[model samples]
Target: MDLDVFVAAHQAEWARLEQLLGRGRRLTGAEADELVALYQRTATHLSLVQSSTPDPMLTGRLTQLVARARATVTGTRRSGWRDAARFFTSGFPAAVYLTRRWWIPTALISTAVGVLVGWWIATHPEIQNAIGAPEDLKAMTKPGGGYETYYSSHPAASFAAQVWTNNAQAAAICLVLGGFLGLPVLYILWQNMLNLGVGIGLMSSADRLDVFLGLILPHGLLELTAVFVAAGTGLRLGWTVIDPGHRTRRVALAEQGRAALGMAIGLAAVLFLSGLIEGFVTPSGLPTWARITIGVAAEAAFLLYVYVLGGRAARAGDVGDVERADQTATLPTAA
Candidate 1:
């Protein structure tokens, strides 16, 4: 494998391919055929040189030439809009639907924990006393109190933006921290449940449970669902770190991480809708039943998206990852 002899042999073919590529749209049929042939030959030369020689300059030049020729052969790719269309239609939902086994139970268990804690606090006066003075708790639960006024504390637009930002941040944390064996995600979920339980307990004890439900349900259904999705996806990622099944740990983490990131983007949009409801519909003069109906509808639609669209995409082998061409891989070590 004399580097000089190899370069001398293939240099003309590589130069011809480069010249054809530089010709752009003006290439003739014969030139196009020649270009393809030279490109293949140069590719083999690249492989040979890579295996038998350590000539960095020659390898780099051939790499660049082959890449340029490939672009000329294949033409440019599709636009960004098409990619976005594909993502929402298939990738995002598929990722969510695939994680149903993880998230559905997360939702159920989180809800159960919140309910149990709320019930206990409502029934136990001593616990309430320990939490705070009865007067303060009473004030918060009373009509036109902290629970009711919190939604209206700021202008509607500002309030919606604030809520959206806060929730999105929480969701992002749950997703990114999932790689740390899911411990942080668990803590986040527990803290969320505890806070929700305390609020429900205080409201119920004050006989303002209806008020609490009316306001919370309108936004919470979708909002909490988004959070649960994040937490669930994160846990799945952590579990992948522990047990990657048939795939290597690195591959599993990368695949699941991409899926989790897709979920994060989808969840952001969901949380935005929830924030809108919280700022406008929840605190609006709409009847309690009407507001709750809107929340229920939104939640149902999201589930349908996951199960129908997502399930279809998953079955078709969409894993919410980038296109195959965009994936990173190491060169084969063996011939």
Candidate 2:
């Protein structure tokens, strides 16, 4: 292939792209259409030259031209509020709904493990002794004890912030490290459930289980669900890397990774709500049933959002990835 011939052939198109880019702020319909077409073609040309040519100056020049053309064609993006609105109304829920098969089962299995462990700890005094001294256990499970007092230990605002930060970090880890064969996600989930089980067991053994549930259920429902979503999505990502079906592994990973990242952001908001509930509603003087009802309502609302809004978007072909125009892609080296 003659680089000189290739450059000569495309020089005219590149010049046209530059001309359109240099035009006035608003474009005519025809000019707008032409700009898009030229941008795509120029991008492809850049790709080809980068792979096939040895001229650094030529490559650099094309790169600059393409970058400028992209800015002119796309213009500035919508505001942050618009992005947030779109995420909750469409992207976040769609991603959650899409991964329902993975996370729903995860919720069930995790709950089961927690229940089983709680039962084991409740019924086995020897196990309770192994966990802590009888007096220490008594101190924790007695009325107005460690379990009940912990929520009120700090100022509500500070506690809410702390919980939000901690939960968000946990969710981030689950989503980000999912590609490590999902083992880390599993470990994190297991450790979480184990702690819950031990807490339930010790509290139940002392007949303070009701108090624990009253406090926990108000925030745990949504908090746990968000965690489960993160873990399940992470596991799915790992599985995709292991078996990407018809798509190339890289493509599959890219798709799922983007979805997982969207979930991470979405879950941050969800966790924030749970943190509010934990710091305010959970420790409030409200009746136990009322607190639990608030938690249940929040959980139900999230589920409805996923099933209705998310399911609709997904069924209509949204995969929760960043908009295609915004997505970065590596040009195939052979293309």
Candidate that scores best on TM-score? 2
Give the runs in model 2 whose Cα sits over 4 Å from its true position: 1-38, 46-65, 329-335
- lDDT string for model 1 (183-253, tens) is 99999999999999999898999888888999899999999999999999999999999998877677778
In model 2, where is the ten-residue run with the lowest total lDDT?
Answer: 326-335
TM-scores of the candidates are: 0.80, 0.84
Q: List the residue pairs that clash in candidate 1.
A: none
Q: State each model's CA lDDT, in order.
A: 0.88, 0.91
User: Model 1 lDDT vs. the true structure?
Assistant: 0.88
Residue-level lDDT for 1 in candidate 2? 61
Per-residue lDDT tens digits for candidate 2, residues 1-335, read 68899989999999998899887778899999998999999899887886677489988888888888887867867659888898889999999999999999999999999999999999999999999999999999998889999999999999999999999999999999999999999999999999999999999998888889998999999999999999999999989989987766777898899889889999999999999999999989999999999999999999998999999999988889888888754554221
RMSD from true fold, candidate 2: 4.0
